[model samples]
Target: MTDSQSNLIDRYQQYRTRRFLANESQTSSWLPGWRTQKRRRILVGALLAIFVAMLAVGVTCHFGVEWAPLLWLPVCLVFMPVWVALRVASGRQDDAPEAVLDEFEIDQRNGARSIGFAVMQSLGLIAAFYLIFGAVITNGDNGDMVYAGGIFTLMAVLIGGCTPAMILAWTRPDPDVDDLS
Candidate 1:
C-alpha cells in the first residue's frame, strides 16, 4: 500500500479509538440495569435467536413465501438496537483498543476474538460451499438458491461479527456494588 493509504488507515483507527472511548462513558448509563451477568446473558441468547430467525426468514422469503418479508421489518429493527445495547452492556470490551484495556481485559478480548475468528472461518467455508454447489446443482436455472445463499452469507457475517461481544457479555461478571458513606 502507498504511504497516503496507510496514513488514511491510521487516521481512521485513531478516530475509531477516540469514538469508542467517548462512547464507553455513555454506555454505562444507556442500560444501567442490563449490565448484570444474568441480563447480559439473556441479551446474548435473544440476539442469537434473532439471528437464526432472520436467516430463516430471509431464506424463506427467497423461496416465494410472501409473508416472510413482512417479518423482516420488526425483527431487523429490534435486532439492530438490541445488538448495540448488548455491545454497550459488555462495555465494548471486544472492540476497545489495547491501550484502553488492562492486561486481563486484553487477554479476555483476544481469546474472544480468536473464537469469533474461528466461527467466522467455519461459517464462511459453509457459505462458500453452499454458493458454489448451489449454482452447480441448479445449473444456474434457479435464482432463488442464489438469493438464499446470499442471505445465508449475510447471516454468517452478522453472527461472526457479534460473537466476540456476545461471548464477553455472557461471561463477564456483574460489577461490584459500592458502599455509600
Candidate 2:
C-alpha cells in the first residue's frame, strides 16, 4: 500500500482507539444538571402519591365516600401513566443522544425523537378519556368500580413513562472501530 494510504488508515485507527478508550474509561453517569435525579424523584413521588390516593379512595368507597368525588379517581389513575410518559419524554432535550448509531445515527435519533413525541401526544388523548369518563360517571350518579379502575389506570400510564429512558439507556450503542470509520 502507498505511504499516504497507510497514514490514513493509521489516523483512522488512532481515532477509533481514542474513542474506545474513552468509552471504556467513562463511568455510566446520569444525565447532567440533576435532571436525572429530579426525574427519578418525581417519578417515585408520583407513584407514591398515586398509591396513597388509591388507598384512600378504596377505603372511602368501602366505607362511605360519596360516589361523585370517587368518579374522579379513575381519571387520576388512567391519566397517571400517560402524564409520566409525557413528562419524561418531553423533558428530554431535542438534541439529546438517546442512543449511539454508527451506521444510522440520524435514523436512530429521528426514531427516538419521533417515539418521544408520540408518547407525549398520547397524554392528550388519555386526558380526554379521563375527562369523558369522569363526566359520564358523575352524570349518571354511579359509584361503580370503574372509578377505581380509572385511577389505577392513570398510575399505570405514569409508570409507563419511565420505560423509554430505561430502554434507551439499556440499548445504547457501543463504540466500534467501524463506527469511527
Candidate 3:
C-alpha cells in the first residue's frame, strides 16, 4: 500500500481501539471506588448513631447520674466506627472528586478512633468499678439493700453499653480503608 494509504489505515485502527476500550470500561461491573467508600461510610455512621443513642438513653434511664460514670460508652460506641469509616472514605484517591472528598476521611477516622478510645476507656472504668465495689457486693453483713442495688445497677449498665460497642468495634475495619491516601 502507498505511504499515505497505510497511515490512514493505522489512524483508523487507533480510533477503533480507543473507542472499544472506552465502551468496555463503561459496561464493566466495576464500582467507582470513591462512591463505594462514601456509601459505606454513610451506612456505618447510621448504624453507629442508632445503636449508641439507644444505649445512652437506656443507661440514662436505668441509673441516672449514677450511670453518668459510664457516659463514655455511648460516645465511644458511636464515635469510633463512624470516624474510621469517614477516614477511609475521605482519602485522596484517584476516584475521589475534589471538593466533595474533603476532610471526610480524616473526620471518619477521628470518629472511629474517638469511639474506640472511648470504649477502651469505658472498659477501664468498669474494671475499676468492679474492683472498688467487689468488697461491698461480697460483704455478708450488707443490711443496706439500697447500696447493694446501686452497685448491681452500675454493673448492669456497664455490661449493657459495652456489649454492643464491643460488637461494633469488632465489625469495624482496623485501619479504615477510607483513610488510605
Candidate 4:
C-alpha cells in the first residue's frame, strides 16, 4: 500500500523474474520472434502432412502403429510445438505478475487447467484398462500396445502444453475498438 513497501515488492519481483529467466534452459538457445514464427509455420505444415498420412492409414490405425515414420512424426509434431511455445512465447505469461490480473488471462488459465485435468483423467482410465487387460489382449506381444501408448503420451503432452495458448487464442479480449480495416 505504502510507497516504500511497493518499491520493495517490485524489487523482489524483478529479482525473481531475472533469476528464473537466467536459470531457464530455453534462454540458452531462445530464438527471436521472427525465427519462432518461421518455425511455427514449418511445424504446422509438418503436422498437417502427418495428419493426412495418419488419415490415409485410417484413424483407427493412427495409434498402436509400428511404423517408425508414423510413430516419430506424431511424437515430434506434438512435442515440438509444446517446447517451442513454452520457450519462445510472447504473451501475458511473459508479462510481470499484476496485482489484478486481466479477466482474459484468468479465464485462459482456468480453461487450460480444466483441459489438462480432463486429458490426464482420460489417459489414466486408458492406462488402467490396458494394465488390467494386458494379459487378455496382448499376452506376449505389446508392439501395438506400446505404439498406442506412445501416441497417447504425445497427445497428452500436446494437449497439456497447448491448452493455455489455444484457450487464450480462442477467447481473446476484443481490441479497444472493433473496426474492419
lDDT of each: 0.83, 0.49, 0.47, 0.50
RMSD of each: 3.1, 14.0, 18.4, 8.0
CA lDDT, candidate 4, residue 133: 73
Cα lDDT tens digits for candidate 4, 1-181: 9999999999988787676655444443454442344444444455446544433343344344445435456656565664455434323342324333477666656766677668767765665565447637778466555555545554555555554544443344432222111
**Predicted structure with the largest lDDT when compared to the true one:** 1
Ranking by lDDT: 1, 4, 2, 3
Task: Predict model 2's lDDT versus the native.
Answer: 0.49
lDDT string, candidate 3, 1-181, tens digits: 9999999988876776566556434433233352343465564456556555645544454344555536555655665565444333332122222223348643544455456556656755764564456546656343233343454444444444433333333444443445332
Q: Which of 1 and 2 is the better model by TM-score?
A: 1
Candidates' TM-scores?
0.85, 0.33, 0.25, 0.50
Question: Can you write out model 2's per-residue Cα lDDT over 1-181, one digit (the tens) per residue?
Answer: 9999999988876776666446433522323232344454555455456556655664455334567454555757654673444334333322333232354654655665566556645754664565567658678454444454454455445434544543343344333434222
Separate clash counts for every candidate: 0, 15, 20, 0
On the 0 to 100 scale, the lDDT of residue 172 in model 2 is 45
Better of 1 and 4 by lDDT: 1
TM-score of 1: 0.85
Best by TM-score: 1
